[model samples]
Target: MSEALEQVAKNKDDVAANEAALEDLFCVISSYNPDFERDLITRAYAYSKSHHKGTLRKSGEDFISHPLGTARICADLMLDSVTIAAALLHDVVEDTPSTIPEVKKLFGDEVAELVDGLTKLQKVSLKSEEEEQAENLRKMIVAMARDIRVILIKLADRTHNMRTICHLDKHKQIQKAKETLEIYAPLAHRLGIYSIKWELEDLAFAALHPRKYSELQQMVSQRRTDRESYVAMAALQLEKELNNVGIQVKIEGRAKHFYSIYTKMVRKGKEFNEIYDLTAMRVLVDTVKDCYGALGIIHSIWKPMPGRFKDYIAMPKFNMYRSLHTTVIGPQGKPLEIQIRTQKMHQTAEFGIAAHWLYKEKGSSAKSKEQAADKLAWLRQMMEWQSETDDPKEFMKTLRIDLFEEEVFVFTPKGEVISLASGSTPIDFAYAVHTDVGHHCVGAKVNNRIVPLHHTLHSGDFIEVLTSKSSHGPSRDWLNFVQTSRARNKIRQWFKKERRQDSEHIGREQLQEALRRKGLASQKIVASPEFSELTRSMGFLKTEDLYVSLGTGKTSAQQVVTRITRDMDSVPDLA
Candidate 1:
């Protein structure tokens, strides 16, 4: 065949392949939403394919493949039709000549808005790369705050990128891998999407440390036979016991992911062989009662290791994760980890908010959706700090702390479970309960015993915060021990408000001193038109803002004086 004819044939083949891919995706979507609009998906796929006609990815695949893969992921999560359509068109406005208004005209407002949010989130640059990354993170969080589906699409897009990341150069691979490990994985974990979180972590780990990844892979593979044999033996024994107890159960074993195993090694300073519970068995039952009954039966069969039990069903994690996790001695005296949960809880444990979103869409009430969304108070807290925090570094620091910290679940006097960062103090708990509760807190009672405000709380602790209206608000000392960003930020805000006047006074004095040194009358310059323009140019709305910035050490007095002199020099002097 002629060259042109051959090229045309290849294009037809690609089109057929793309259609097959979309057919598979449609099957997945129909399983969840039988009435989902096939026409919308078909239009989106064709629009994306045409827009990306000549574009190819680094992996030498059609650029259309990326969006198609992303949309499939969203479909697997049972996301709404609009999100799937947005996923199909997410890169169109950014990478192609298409614009948001064009997308809105083509699709509807919901898809256009999501595409716009993803577009804005993709563009971030500032003074340095670190600042740019921090800014990008802030943008993603803000976008999520507005519409949670934005991050959902972004995460789907990232998962596809990581899956095909090997096409990039070494430096690019490491950079993308680190970003995924640091930002995206944690976001997935925070959302309680373990399926995505685990995949992201393992993929990133492989990219960032290829040698260590190979080492761990070899180690796990080498032990597969023995592990499988042991798991089968344990499963059989457990099945017999549960059946005897009249509990219907399905037990399955899973190898711990490489990233999690590596984390355990580094955290415990142990070698691969030194670590136990390399495999975990999950028991899925029909009811919450069966979950407890299975846990009891498992414990009766094997002696549980000390302090290795976590009853998350009684108190779910901040991300709405619930399971009864325990490590016990098993056959051949090896440590065996097990989790017991109802089949419904198992779904939530794996799919997290996506499962809730699916529930909300299946004719569930609006109130049910709100209840699921209320669990994401962390997202709202990020928005609060983003508004208050001007420094990108500070915002990223708080974000890292919030994401990476292990959780500790404590209870209030009213039997409400409040989740705080591990090593959290009573002040953190107080703020978690209410800002007023934290400000008025004078002392605390952990399990009915008086304890210092700085005492580090443990799980299952019943805390009672003692407050008095006559007492002063939070102490500067609380800043030293508070763990949660909410507690720390609230304390700083209190101080900032209380000391604003003093800061203004000090800042004015510093400026006047600098003016005296420059042989300029302080009052004349302060009231000058030049000064008004300078303050506005310096990003202050009013003179008090300038003073506050100076007092807070955010603006140096010398910096202000230098700007003033420079502005004066630029202007023509009037006689």
Candidate 2:
């Protein structure tokens, strides 16, 4: 066949495959949302296919499959039609000659905004990988603050990419896997999407640590055959007991993901055989009442281990996870783990914030919006911290801390539950309450007993931050013990604001000395409007910023004077 004819035939085949994929995606959407707008989604799919027609992924599959995969993930999450459409078109504005305005004109503002949010800053001239990453995250966060669906789409896109990542070179694969493990997986966990989170972790773990992943996979496979009969017997016993109590239940055994198993091994310094809860049995009931009833029935069957019973149903996790977890001695005298929850709670536990869409009705968008706001309060707090943080490295550092830290649920004196990072001191707690409260904090008492400022906090500790009218401000020592970015950023901002005047004074003197050494008219240049213009041209908001930069030794006196000599049209007479 002629080359042109072969190329045309390939395009035709790609289109036919993409159409089949679209049908599968639509079926997923209709399974949950029968009333979804098929026209809108079809248009988006066709548009994406048209734009990305000739392109191909590293795996040699047509590029349209990538968007189709991403959109399917979103549909599986039971996301709205607009979100699924945005997922399809996310890379169009970025990779193709298509523009945002064109998307907006065709799809409306909502879909356009979401696509734009997922688009990276490919055109910007970033100085470093860190800067580019930080800026890209900054853009996504801004869009997320406006609409949380932007992040949902981004997560779906990332999940799809991670699925096909093996097609790339080994170095590229490892790099992408590390990034997924460090950022995207944790973000999914925070958002409470365990389905995606578990997949991302396992995929990244496999890519980054192939040998360990293989060994773990082999271990899990070998153990599965041995444990099948044990799990079946346990399920039968639980089924009989639950039936006797007149509560309907579904029971299944779930294996721990490879990365989670890896984390447990490293954290406890134990081998796989030493891990008791390699597989856990989940009990799903029809109602909350049945959830507790099943828990009782399970406890009656086996003795639950102390310090292993967690009642998350009463006190749900920040990520909206609700369940009754217990570790018990099961048949044959081996330790068995069990989680009991209602079907609705299971949905929330599995899907996190995305489950909100599954339960949403037409007129309840206002309530859903309110629920999303409450669920994503941490995202807003992150935005505030990032805005105050100027350094790209600092932003990424603080972001990782926020994303990775395990939560400790503390309380205020008034009994309001306040969540902070584990190992957080009273300083972090005070800052979490309010910035002013943090600044004016004089002392702290945990559970009505006075504790030192650097004392680490734990769950259920009632924190009382005592403030005095005559208090000076936050101590510099607090930064050493503080675990939250908010506390650290606030402390740094305080010092910077307090030292600005001194820095400006020192900076002015340095510039004058430099000019005198060069035999220029120092006083005349200092007083001239030309100097202010030069400061503005140097990317400073005002003359004082340039002075402060010089005073802080961030910009040397020689560099500033040299720029001034070169930029100025007229030079002052030599002294």
Candidate 3:
């Protein structure tokens, strides 16, 4: 190697070494907390460094740099000292010789417990790759339910991992990138951590769909100058207008991320130029009163598109994201998205639950705890349902379906608001209320108008479930229609124990009928060698279990038969 090239490489290594940035993190954490335990955190850093003595990442950088970056991310959230410490040591037990007992002795039970949670969530292969991911996600969610900090630290860890993903094999990069986009990004969004959510989506997008991401990146880059100029003009106009109204405002322009644009394109079937929010602006101001005032001034300045305004501040989202959004007709005959929020709201929107500590708490710890419990109730419920649901594939499907959905807000008869995934029926509403309510649910009145059990709920609808003591229980059809895991489980549980013979008989009958329709016989199909493989592939133990699953409404008979037929076709003369 040439000396000049070696010197340049040394400089690059110096740049890549992130220890100096970690020092900045130490200063930031200590700045907010003067008496912060600098020694304790530094001790964790020293221990992790010692344990990861001579490791390197696929990026050819020091392995310790990953955890250091993760720790910095945690510090950016202004998390508690213990959380930051755990972030520093998250990968130690997984990748190094460090043990949980050692972590406990060195860092105390709190840090050790968090680290154990991360360790116990190791990805285990079930029957297939899908099953492995589902089981892994289940464990992670269950752990997250126990302690919210687990997910926060995991997000930070994932953030650093994705940021340095370039060093990985192309296939692994695509795999991790897809996982980040499909799972972690939504998890972060569900937690209301926009700071993590937006970047994770973009990074994952870049890795998974490199050419498309590059195209979008270049498209946005090409418009950067014009967009910046428009935003500058708009900001001056809006700031001046708000100032005239005795409101102080800070304005900034935001370019929508590549993944967000790609999602819009795919979901809405829109082109890049058709995305109105690409060139957007944010107006941060003092006081909620000023926030609303700025909105009024913005509306006066430009005509707002009808129905484009969402008052998230008045009714915060399930993740506690608070801001007011609107779309206005802007200077170049283009639509502009404008978000108005107080400084506190902006902080909370960015950091999510972490902001609770960063900003001074408005309520007592007891109230904060109550709010946190409310926010994580859905997660706890999903994890609890995992044990009740027999099929891990079904459980994973339900988990993903329920996790990323937009919710509808409904009012109970007593006027208490309940939030549920959009498209959830009144049966889902009853189950969301309670298991007994769902089990006993016979009919419902949506908005005081009597409706069937399958009546789809909408935001602002008032629902009253009518139960009868004499009612037999949930119908099997509820499995086909009910949108919540809780409701589905309650119904599945009823049939699972109520009539095994009847369910088995029905299951057999259904499978026979399906086979007959396909011009095949049930016995011949079941006796085939591929039948057991088919059952196992479906996450069933035996043919009888598959029948029972079909009868009990845990799975589909037609779907299973269709799969069997496809498998049979793949091998000639199977029977």
Candidate 4:
């Protein structure tokens, strides 16, 4: 059969599948909305199909199937009609010649606006494929300024694509997988979509490096039968023990992700057999009190691993993920991590951002809704940052640093908890709390130990910042000492506005020093077309302006040097 014919057949199958999925999805919606907007959803799906009629994806599936899958995921989230409609038409403008006006005509202005918000700029070009990808990411962020739902829908589409990426070529598979790992996964994390983020990472890791993927998969699969049996027996025992104590709990087991396993192996230099807690049992109870009550029962039955306990219920992760993690040695002397949480935490863990819909559907308490809303604040902040920053490269850089970094939880003297990226110093924490705290920071106390402000905080560390009124505001050097982009950006903003002359002077000296180390002075190098073009390509209009921007901390020095070398390599030598 011809490729086009195969695609048409596949699309027919997809449409059928989507109908079933949509039917199930409508049931969920029916519980929430007495009069579900079924007509609008049908119209959106029909419009998507018509818009993408002749187009086939690299996987030889009809392009419309992608949008339908995205819409199904959105509907599963119980998102508003506008969001679901947007998901249906998200790729119409970007992948097809169908205009926003066409979408507006077919659906409505709200749907069209979302489609436009999700569309990528078609005309921008960059010198390298990597640069082009980065620029495309920036364009996406810019589009996010119009509406946050656009990016959310795009993320869902990417997740579904990654799941089915095996149909693409090896090269394309790796490319798409890498994009998912670097861009879409991080975007999902920032949006508090942990389930999507985890799956995206695991799938992308599997496709990009099949050898390691299969190795870990085999290792994980080998013990699955035994692991299931152990968990079942343990859960049964725990249930009876808890039931005798008048406590109710739901217990289940989950295997760790391949990427997560591989990461631990690489970091700890441990073989697969050395890694304990591969399969974990989770207990969900009715109330927070019950969560602790269940935890005590588990500990009474099994010996808990020393120093392997975490209470996120009191001080949750930045994403608002809450649970009590305790590694305990079970009946066989095998280490097993048991997670204790309330039913709310289980829903958040499984559905993440979609938990909002679940809560709304069930008429959950106001506290539950507020908890979900509080977690979404980060997403709003990300959208705001994208709006305030015009530099796409900067936005991408900040996002990469934030998304890929792990976090540590610390506490203030009054017992208020603060979360910072792992490797973050007190300076990062001070800045995270408030700019004034960072600016006036003189010293820090980690667990009451008088430490320098650069001390990296660990979990459960009680931090106290020592401030001096006579002390100067944050030094330019503090920027380098901080781990988070939030701290670094605030430092730069202060220097950019408050100490312009000093910043310019320091920036100039730094540039000259960097050039001197590179064996190319500004006088000799700035005159070269390679250098000038490199600066221009990096978004600076002039070579001196580039240096000044670097000095003022607006642009990164390393990026400037790397671009110069790359530009020089591309220039034809005339000996």
After TM-score superposition, the amount by which residue 399's alpha carbon in candidate 2 deviates from its true location, in angstroms, is: 1.2
Residue-wise C-alpha lDDT for candidate 2, range 106-218, written one tens digit per residue: 99887887788777534366999899888877776776677777888888888999999889999999988998998889889988999999999999999999999999999
Per TM-score, the best of the predicted structures is: 2
Ranking by TM-score: 2, 1, 3, 4
lDDT of 3 at 137: 85
- C-alpha lDDT of residue 112 in model 2: 88
| Candidate 3 minimal-lDDT segment of 10 residues | 359-368
List TM-scores for all candidates, in order.
0.88, 0.88, 0.82, 0.78
Worst 10 residues of 4 by lDDT: 359-368
What is candidate 3's TM-score against the reference?
0.82
Q: How high is the CA lDDT of each candidate model?
A: 0.88, 0.88, 0.83, 0.76
Candidate with more favorable, higher TM-score: 1 or 2: 2
Per-model tally of clashing residue pairs: 0, 0, 0, 1
Candidate 1, superposed: residue stretches over 4 Å from native: 1-13, 359-371, 468-473, 507-540, 546-575
Candidate 3 per-residue lDDT over residues 1-575, each given as its tens digit: 99999967965674456568668878888776666667778888888877886787787667778778898888878777777888889889998888999999999887899899988877775788888887888888778766777888999999999999998899999999989977899888888899899999999988888899999989999988988999999888878888887898889997687887898899999998887778799999989988888888888889999989988887788788889999999877788899999988998898887665453222343454456667766777777788787676787788778678888888998989898888999999998998888889989999889998888998889999999999888888888888877787778888777787688788988988877777776777777778888889888887787888888899887898779778774433324
Name the candidate, 1 or 3, with the larger TM-score value. Answer: 1
Off by over 4 Å in 4: 1-35, 120-124, 127-147, 358-397, 447-449, 502-575
How well is each residue in 1-575 modelled by candidate 4, as lDDT tens digits? 99999867876797787677667656765665656567887787777788787777776666777887787777666566667777887877887678988888877777787787777644368776756766776677566544556666877888888878998889889888988988888777765677788889999999988999998899889989999999998899999999999998888897788888898999999999998878699888999999889888889999999999989888776666789999999868888889999888876665565565442322342444365556665444455455455555776787788777778888889988777889999998887788788889998988879998777789889888888999878888887678887787777777666665666667767765666666665555656777777777778686667766877788776666666666676432222
Clashing residue pairs found in predicted model 2: none
Error of 2 at 203 (Å): 0.7
